[model samples]
Target: MGTVWPDVRLSDSGDEAPTSPQRSHLIGGHDSKSYLAICSESAVNWLKARVSSADEQSVTDIVTRLSRHADYKSTFMCPPKLKQFPEPDMQMAWKYCQEYFDNRVETLFGAIDRRQFEARLRAHLQDGDNSDSDPSWYALRNTIYATGTRLLLTRTGCDAKTIHESAMQYFLNALSVHTQVLFARQVDLTGVQALTIMSFFAENLLGSSIESMLCSNAIRVAQGLRLNYEPVSNERLSPSDRFVGNRIWWALYCYDKHISLRDGRQSCIDDDDISCALPERQASENPNKFEIFMQMIKSAQIQSLIYKKLFSAAGRRQNTIQERAAVEQLDQALSEWRDSLPLHLRPGAPIKKSSLPAGVHIDPVVYMHYTYYGTVIAMYNKFPWTARGSSLDNAAFGREKAVSAARSVVLATRYIDTDMNTTGCLLFSYPMTALIVLFVHILQNPLAPSAHSDVVLMDMATGHFAQLEFATSMQLEVQFVRDMAHIARRAVEQIRRDAWIDVTPFEAPEPAIFSPTMTGPNLNFMDFLTDDVYAV
Candidate 1:
C-alpha cells in the first residue's frame, strides 16, 4: 500500500508556515490552515458563535464512539478532522490555497467568479482561539486546501509521491466529513462547485466508479439550486452574476455529458429542458479559456446527438439512405463549426517537428481541433469503409472520409511533440484516435503511398502515450492510452497475418479485414475510451 500522509504532518516539504506578514498574500491560506488570521471582527464573531454554539457536542459523541469501537486499533490512523495551526503555517497554507484557487479557473474548476469566491472565503474565515475544537467549516476549508494544492502541484509538475498522498489525506477527509449536517439542506453553488472540482480530479486520477457518482451529485446539487433554469433579471442578480450562473450551468451540462458519453449512459440534464443561454463573454475571463469551454460544451452537445442519432435504437434502424443523410448533415455542421473558429483559436501550422521538452509551450488550440477531428473520425467509423459501392453507398464514403480524416489526425499528432502537452489524460483520445485510424487503414493498404510514414507516426504517438503513463498523475487515463497502443500494435500484426491468410483461401478471414463497422475489436479509440454506444 502507498504511504498515506496526514493532512498537517511534519515533513521535509519546502513550503512551511510563513511568519512575515508581508509575504502572506502569495501563499494560499484557508486552503492550508482553513484561516490563518480572521481580519474582520464579524468573521471572528461568526467563528466564536459557531464554536460556542452547536455541533460541538455531536462531534464529541462521534469521537468517543470511534475510540470505543469493538475492533478499534491504535495502529490504524483515524479520519482527520479540522486541525488548528499556529499563526504562521495557517497563513502560509491559506496564501498558497488562494493562489492555487485562482489558477483553478484554467486548471481544475471552470468558470467561477474568483472575486466573489475570494470574498466568501474571507467572510468564512474568522478570528478564533480554539486549537482543540473541530468545526465543519474547518473541514471544508481543509478540503479546499487539499483540492487547491493538488491542482497546483499537478499542474506545476510536482509529481512527488509524498505531496500527492498528503493531498489525498485531506481530500478523503473532506469527502468523509460528517455529511449529516453538511447536506441537510440544498447545497449552495459553491458546494456544487467543490463537487465538480472533485469529480474532475477523480476522472483524471481514474478513481473507478466514484468519478461518475461525484459528477452525479454535482448535477443534483446544481439542479436543486435551480441553476439548470435561467434566472430572470427581475430577481435582482446583476447581469454579471447571471452570466456566471449560466456559465456554471453549462459547465455542469458539459461535465454531465462528458461522464455519460464516456460510459455510454444517459446524461442527467436533458438538453430539451436547458433554456439557459451560454455565458456572455466578460473582461475577467480569458477569451481563449472561454472559447475552449464553449467548444467543449458544443462538442458535448454533438456527442449527445451522435449517441441518439447514430448509436441508439433510432440509429440502429435498417434505413441506410436516411442514416446517410442524417450523418451528412452532422458532418456538414461540424465542418462549419471548425471553419467558424476565430483565426487564432483555429489550429495553427506546426512550429517544429522535433520532440519538445515538458516546459515547452504547446498551443491548446491544437487540442481543440484534435477533439473535433477525432469526432469526425468516429463518425466515419459508423459505416464500414469500402472501395467499391453504389453511388450513395455509405461504406465507400466512410472509407474515403475516414482515411482522409485519419491522415489529418496522424499528421497533427506527428508534428506536435506530446511530451510538452500539459493536459495529459484529457487529450488521450487525440493521438490514440489518430493511431487507431491509421492502424485500420494501413492494414487494408500496407503497400499504399504514405503507409510506412504512417507506421512511424503511430510509433511516435504510442511512445508519447507510453511516456505519459508513468510521468503523469493520471494513472488510469495513461493506462487506457497504453492499452489502446497495445491494441493498435496487435492490429498491425493481425492485419499482416490476415494478408497471408487471404492468399491461403482455406484460412479464416480476419474480422478487421472489413472492420469499418464497430464490430469486434476494430473499435475507434476516440469513442472507445468513454462512449461505447456503438460497441458490438
Candidate 2:
C-alpha cells in the first residue's frame, strides 16, 4: 500500500490561548486562539450586505453593523460575495462603496457620516489595532483602490494612463500582502480572504512582461512549501491551498485571455476598452515603452521555457499514450455495451450528446487573437535561434552560452511538465507546430518594411513565446484539456441546436490536416502545422 504522508505534528505543541487582545476578536472571549472564523463570518455578512443592498442606504446600514462587530472591525475579511454581483450594476455598487470614502474614516462603514466614511475606512485600515491581522485585510484595504479603478473605467471614463496611475500603489500593496500569505506557515482566516486579493493581483498585474515576477513568486512559494514541513492550523490550509492553486491556474488563464484581447504584436491598449488599463499595466510597462516591450519578450521567453520544462517533467509521471488510448478504448466499449442493454433492464437512459455540460463560452475573435499571439511569441523568443536547443553542458566558454540557454529551457520545461502531469493531468494540443509555421513564414517573407520594425519584431517574438509557453505548459494536463474541449464542443453543439445555427455534434476533426472553411481566428493550435509535405 502507498504510504500516506504523515500529518506534521507541531513541535511547540500547546493548548495555550491567544493573548487578551487576540481573544477579543474571536466568537467568544473564552481564551480563544484565532479570530479566523468570526472574521470570515463577518466578511461574508459584510459582502452579502453590500451585494444584497438595493441602494446605498442599505449598504450603509450593513457597514454600520459590521463596524460594531469586533470580527469586522479588528479582524480581517474578504467577501467573495462581490463576485456574484451582476456586471450591469457593479459600477453603481462600486460608486456607492466609494461615495462613503471621500475621507480616511470609513471605506466600508464607520460611525461617522458618509463624507467621513473614506477617512474612517483609511483610518481603520491604517490603524495599528486593526492592521495586519491577515492578508485579506490587505485586500480589503485595497478595495477602495479597486473601486477607484472601477470608477476610472466606468464612471470617469478616463484614459488607461490616468486609471493606471491612480491604482498602482494599492495594487502593489495587495501584492505585497499576497506574497506574505502565500508563504505563511500558519495559514489562517486572513489568508483565505487574501486569496481573492491575490486572484485580482494575478489577473491585472501578471499580463505583460512582468508575468515572470508572478511565475517566479509562484515557483518559489511552491518550492518553499515542498521544503518546509509546516503543520496546518485552523481551516486556512484547506481553502488557502485551493485558492493559491487556483490563482496559479487563473494566472496562466489570464495570460491567455490578455493575449487574446490585446493585439498579437502590441501590449498597449486601444484607448477605449475598460480593461485595457489596470494598475498592473503601470507596473508592467514602467520605465518606458521600449523597456516594457523588452521585458515582456524576456518574460514570455522565460514562461515558454518553464512550460516546456513542466511538460517534459509531467510526461514522465503520467500514463503513456498507449495506456491512455487503451483506457479510452475501454471506456468507449463499456459505453457501447451500456447503450446496448434492453429498455427495461437499462439504467435510466443516459442523456444524449445534446445534453452535456455547458462549454466555456468564449469570443471567437478573442480566442483566435490569443492563440496567434502565443504561437508567434514562442517561436521567436523561447527558442531564439533553433528549436533543438540543448540542455546539457560543462564549459565556461562563450561557445557554451548557446548550450546553457538550451539547457535552461530544458530544465524549465521539465519542472513545468511535472506539475502538469502529476497535478493538472489534462491534455491539450501543443502549440509547437504553430510556432514553427510562424518562424518559417517570417523567414521566407519578411513582414513589409512599413509594417515590420524593431518594435513589431520584439512584440511578435514575445507574443508567440507566451502562446508557446501556455500551450506547452498545458499540453500534458490531459484531464483539463479534455474537459475544456468537451465543454466547448458541447456548448457549440447546443448553440447549433438552437434555431439560430442548427447542426449536429461534430466528429473529431482529422489530425495533421485542417479544413479550409473551418479556419478562423480561434483555430486549434494543431491546425497551424504544415502538411506532411513540409515536415522537417
Candidate 3:
C-alpha cells in the first residue's frame, strides 16, 4: 500500500490501510514502490514546512489533498453510501428504547442526535409502504435499536444469563448488518454511528481487540469527512449540521483517547490536528451529557499521555522521578475535575441508590467514581515502591493512600450497573493496574494492615474479567486486554505460593505469562521469640 501521510507515523501498529497492491489516484500509472518514494519525498517536505507554522489554510489543504488519495479515501476521506434494513415495526422502535439510552448510554457518549434519528426513522416509515427503502439508514437504525434493546433487557431483569445471551445476539446481528452494508457501499455518517455503537458493545462484552479496531475505524472515517474541523465555523454547513458534526467529532475523539490508553499506545489522532470545540449544552438540558462527556474526554486525554510517556515501548525511558511528578500533577487535576462536577454527578452523591435495591438501575456517577480511583492507583503504582526491594524506601502515607484508593475502587465496583453500563469494564487494565499495586504491596509487606484483604480484592477483581477475550470485530485479532488479565491472575497465584499458602493451580498447565523473575532473599527476617507468626 502507498503511504497515506509520508511525514507522520500515525499509529504504533500501522493498522490503518490494507496491504495488497492497488492503483491510487496520487500515483496512477506509476509503479507502486517508485510512486511511494516519489510521494513520500514530496509530502514529507511539505509537511516539514507546515510543521513550522501550519495555519488553517495549509492544514485544510493538506487534509484535502490526502483525503482524495484513492488508496485511503475510504478509510479517511470519502463517505460510503448507505443501505436500508427492513426490520419488523415492533423491533424498529421498541417501547422505551430511546429513554433507556438517554438515561444511560447518552450520558456516557453524546455522539448521536437522538431526536433527529427518531425523526428520520419516522419519516422513512411514513414515506409509504410502496416506496423503496434506504439501506444506508438501516445500519444506524439496527445499531441504535440493538443498543436500546440490550439496555432494556438488563433493566427489566430478563434472567442474568438470558440477558447476556440475548444482548449478545442483538449486538452480533446488528454487527453483521452493519458490516454487510459497509462492504456493499462506502461508509457514511450513519455507518460511523453504527460502528461507534459497536465499539461500545465490544467493551461492554469485555472484547479487547474489537473495541480498539472499531474505534480506530470510527475515528478514521470521521477525519476523512473532516469532522475534526468546526462545522459551524465553516460556511458550508447550517446550524443544525454544525451541532451534529461537533457532537460526533467529540465522541470519536473521546473514543480514540480511550483505545490509546487501553493499548498503552500513543493516540491515533493528534490533538494538534483537531479544530472542533467540545459540544455545548443548552440551559434546559436535563442529563448534562455534554458536560460529563467533555470532562471524560479531558480525563482520558490525561490518562493517554500517562500511558504514552511512561508505558509505551516507544517511550521506555523510565525516569521514575520525572514520571512521578507527572503522575502527581495528573492526580491533582483529576481531583479538581471531580470536585467541579454537579452534585448528582459527583461520586458518593446519593445517585439512585436508595431508590433501587437492584444494582442494574444506577446513576452513571458510580462508574465515574470507580474509574477515577482506578486511575489514581495506576498513577501511584508507577513509583519504585512496587518493586521488591522498595519496601524500606517506600513512604507510609503514599502506600496508605494507594491502599485506600484501591479499596475505594473495589467497593465502587459493587454498584457498577453491570447489566446496563460497562464503561469502566472496557478498560480492563485500569482495574488490573489497581490490583497489581495491591499485590506488590502485599508481597513487599505481608503483615501490613488487612494484608489478606488486599489479596482477596485482587482475586475478586480477576473474576470480573471472565467475559473478556478475543471476540472478533471484523479482522482485528489482538487480545490486548485479555493478555493483561492472564498476567494479573498469574501474579496473584505467585503471591499465594511465595507466602507458603495453598495454591489451586490453573486447570491447564502452560508456559508462564510473564518471564521468570530472578529471585533471591532480599529482606532480613526479624528474628523473633515466637517465630511462628513471622515464619514463611
Q: Could you tell me which 10 consecutive residues in candidate 1 have the lowest summed lDDT?
A: 30-39
- Tens digits of per-residue lDDT, candidate 3, 339-389, equal 776664564333344442322224345546655665555445433312334
Ranking by TM-score: 1, 3, 2
Query: Which stretch of 10 consecutive residues in model 2 shows the poorest summed lDDT?
Result: 1-10
Native-vs-model 2 lDDT? 0.29
What Cα-based lDDT does every candidate model obtain? 0.48, 0.29, 0.48
How do these models rank on lDDT, best leading? Answer: 3, 1, 2
Question: How does model 2 score by TM-score?
Answer: 0.31
Q: Per-residue alpha-carbon lDDT of model 2 for 126-215, expressed as tens digits? A: 543434456555554454455445344534555433444445545456655665677676644334333433333333321122332343
| Clash totals, every prediction | 15, 45, 8
The C-alpha stretches of model 3 lying farther than 4 A from their native spots are 1-86, 91-103, 127-136, 168-170, 177-187, 232-237, 312-315, 343-363, 382-402, 420-433, 456-536
Top candidate on TM-score is 1
Candidate 1 lDDT score at position 19: 24
Better of 1 and 2 by TM-score: 1
Model 1 stretches with alpha carbons more than 4 Å out:
1-89, 105-110, 123-125, 128-144, 151-157, 177-183, 207-209, 233-241, 351-364, 382-394, 403-427, 440-450, 472-536
For each candidate in turn, the TM-score is 0.63, 0.31, 0.61
